[model samples]
Target chain A: MQWLTIYKKECLESARNYKWVWVPLVFILFCIMDPLTTYYLPQILESTGGLPDGATFDIPTPPAANVFMMSISQINTLGVLVIALITMGTIAGERKSGVAELILVKPVSYTAYVTAKWAAHVTLVLLSIFVGLIASWYYVQLLFGDVSFIHALSTAGFYGLYIIFVISISLFMNTWTKTPGLVLFLTISIIMILNLVTSVFSHLLEWSPTNITSYLPSLLRTGEVGQDLWLASLFTIVTIVLLLFGAIQTLKRKEIV
Target chain B: MIQLKNLTKTFDKQYAVKNITFNLPSGKCVALLGPNGAGKTTTLKMIAGLMHPTSGQVELANGVKGDIRKYIGYLPQHPQFHSWMTGMEFLHYVARLSHIPKHESQKLAEQLLDRVGIADAKNRKISKYSGGMKQRLGIAQAMIHKPSVLLLDEPVSALDPIGRRDVLNLMEELKQETTLLYSTHILGDAEEASDEILLMHKGAIVESGSLQDVKERHQVDKITLRFDGNMKAYKEKMEEFPFVTHTDIQKQKIHVYVQNVPEARDVLLELVSKEQWPLLFFEVGQTTLEDLFMKVVNEHAMADHL
Candidate 1:
């Protein structure tokens, strides 16, 4: 695609400046902190056992899966917020900074620009999730025995899709709003709307973007790709298409004054 | 060549750009001059394909297919960039949008960042960059693709003198590779940089030509001579002549306005023969850009007033 140049550039920048240097440092620190906190929480709870149902602890025996899951929560789990922050800067920040006018003038169409943004964001998000997962995997092995590794890897696939879906949704929100604060607020509002609506219609809503929000948790809860997994995938794809199309059109047609 | 034929851009019932026909040839800069809301930017946007003209075609030269955008570099009135991106990242992202290969995007982006003089600050996040720095990065991103037509709308309005000079110099440098279509009300800039001026007033081109050619429109040979007696009769008589456009009698002086002063002088010499009037002063005033602008605006305003 015409957007590949921008996409690759985004990947390199994100890798070098965004996570390659930042996430691992943060995650490694969390790696220590996560286990240390988990390890000591039980003792702390036991010491404070005199309190009525206070300081009750459910600390996991430092297993690979537990460390990995904790690491995922610490690093990759900011998926929504991180992706939202990244996407908001893509279109909204550019527009606000007045760089859009300059770029749009150069033989780049609104479609190509928007698509490039979508692709760059998706690539970054996927990389972030994968890198964090891999890091967690490494730490998990260091912490617990290899036996704790999820024997069925299908769950990871479902989780990967779910996280990517969250990223796509975040990018879509970024495109819709150029203000970071607004996108942040909008992302939360959208997630809340989807979650609230889907929860109300729990078993009925199949093709809702919000359902994809649970795709990761669902895989963790149920090892198989349930109705929610397929439904979430479907919802994410459809919404991504529609939102990206709208973003492209808006970008192409709007004057960058 | 960029030909906008009858390019009408209407918002609601108010026609922002009404039946605009203009030709921007390759390798020539066309300065779009107008007051606020005169539709200069709208017309430029239509050419840049940022806004679709309500009714008309923005046809590019040589029938370039699949969106003429590849051939165009547009610097909007206000440039924007991804906040999370550095000045360098902004260019990189634009390189991707331009279809530059992944392997080459970084080199090209770095090159552009250097070209725009933001190389030192390239690593700084765009949100942290200054307005002029952001604009420089904006220019870098727009030029990264080396497009054929560069559309710069008020490209220097935000910059300080140095930034403006850099941007202007960059424009001059870019002209070696691409045509520059700049839009601004700053007549001095139009005079300094543009090969031609497209004067827009009231949603239409009141004048379009080389600066000199446009200045010719308001060129007038004016002379005033005092009559021995009342000059009202002479003023009245001068107006009757087809050659005399405007004649006024103020106190004892008779003022005569003519297209060709020398020829009008010859005619006035004949008038001297017929009736004796004290010759006062004669001067030829060539039109300036400001004069042309005023003349066109006044003519249009008068027409509308009528």
Candidate 2:
């Protein structure tokens, strides 16, 4: 019950800070930009007049699925950074600023505090990603060809897990340090290392969380979920639960020293 | 009521607060008094449950079984709030955290705002409030749950003189409602506002008792003399008296310790009259709390050095 109260406070604070508005706006912009550029590249290049005289370049229109996947890929880099940057300060900054002391001194449980924050961050990220996927799906249908709504929905779900995993990393890092800058650095570094290990051993890493990224776009292209998708999803979900539990324990141990 | 049993905190093998024990009786105003870095804040933090002690524990002595923090309210040295929130909004948020129902939270928040004298500023953003207003808001937020014990660390140390008076008056008004244990280095405020005093030095309590009892325990029989001219010659002359134990001058006033105040007062007055000394002012048997604080702290420091 207290967790729900705290969860509502976190959401209100995020809205007050315009996080609810701008994060989704950034996602939508990234999603829409992908299709617009893919469709207009040939004409944009021809109108520029910077190419050598009589020089020719053939640019083919990619499938709607490719455009949608490209939009998500664009989000995979910049949008992840935006989410991490926003979440980096949620715990670390509050703890350093002494606001955490103000709240934790109450009767509230450490689990409630950490869980409420985790839930709020996950909700915002998932909602924004879903809205972005839908907008991009519409643009792709108009400019290219037909891509099923189910594919877009599945893409958001798989990729949403990856984003939530990133958020978990931020929360875990937050409990380790009171500096937002340090949290951001550590979360990004951990994510980069995970991605590297997954790519270097793709054939062997069927259970790796980063495998969900590759499986998502392939699902969009082939219209069939990969055999490894469920394994990777299971792995990501388990990691998220463990990381959240770790953050709660870390906070309980730290205790505003 | 609350009791701290041998609580201690250490960082990197160095004690931030050494073993400290005390009891806060219900409905009493206790002041934790010390200079900066004397562990006053650390002691308060441990009691507030914001920091855990390396050894010992803090528990409610009122037969409460659950979390002691549920019955406690804490205000830090520099209380920070979400500046974007209005005064009323912040109180409502704190009320919700304390699990007060939505229907009653608004009424409690409004009442607390009026009690702390910030009701008119209820709708104003916290960021735009003055330092004093912000401090009042912080107090209101801490009291939302009507906790049994209220812990404030240096509540008025950051305020202007007027703000200091305002908060001190508020504390005076609030002591009747709850057990108030606050920390401050301002001896004058402690003398004015608190019923009990815990004097801390170098991370340990050097003295603790009711205000009247502690002062009486350290009380000295002495006469203060001020002259129109140089007081050093007068001090030397006074030191020659058989009953005078020692003599010290502060701010041109000679403080002469004596064996008996009644006899010393009569003898000193006779001498000043008979010798026709230019005595601008004379007083007897007045030992200020500042004098006791200095003497106690200096004595402890000397013992440490020895």
Q: Each candidate's fnat, in order?
A: 0.75, 0.86
Off by over 4 Å in 1: A15-39, A45-79, A109-116, A126-147, A151-153, A206-257, B11-13, B78-146, B155-178, B192-195, B222-284, B299-306
Question: How well does candidate 1 reproduce the true complex, by DockQ?
Answer: 0.38
Model 1 / residue A145 / CA error / Å: 9.3
Q: What's the residue-level lDDT of A84 in candidate 2?
A: 84
Best by DockQ: 2
Task: Kindly list the per-residue Cα lDDT of model 1 for residues B149-252, writing each as its tens digit.
Answer: 88887888778999888988887788778888888887777888888899898889878888777766656666777756566776787887777877655556
State how far residue B137 of model 2 sits from its true place (Å): 1.2
Predicted complexes: DockQ each: 0.38, 0.76
Worst 10 residues of 1 chain A by lDDT: A147-156
Global lDDT scores for all candidate models: 0.70, 0.88
Candidate 2, residue A79: Cα displacement in angstroms equals 0.8
In model 1, the Cα lDDT at residue B263 comes to 79
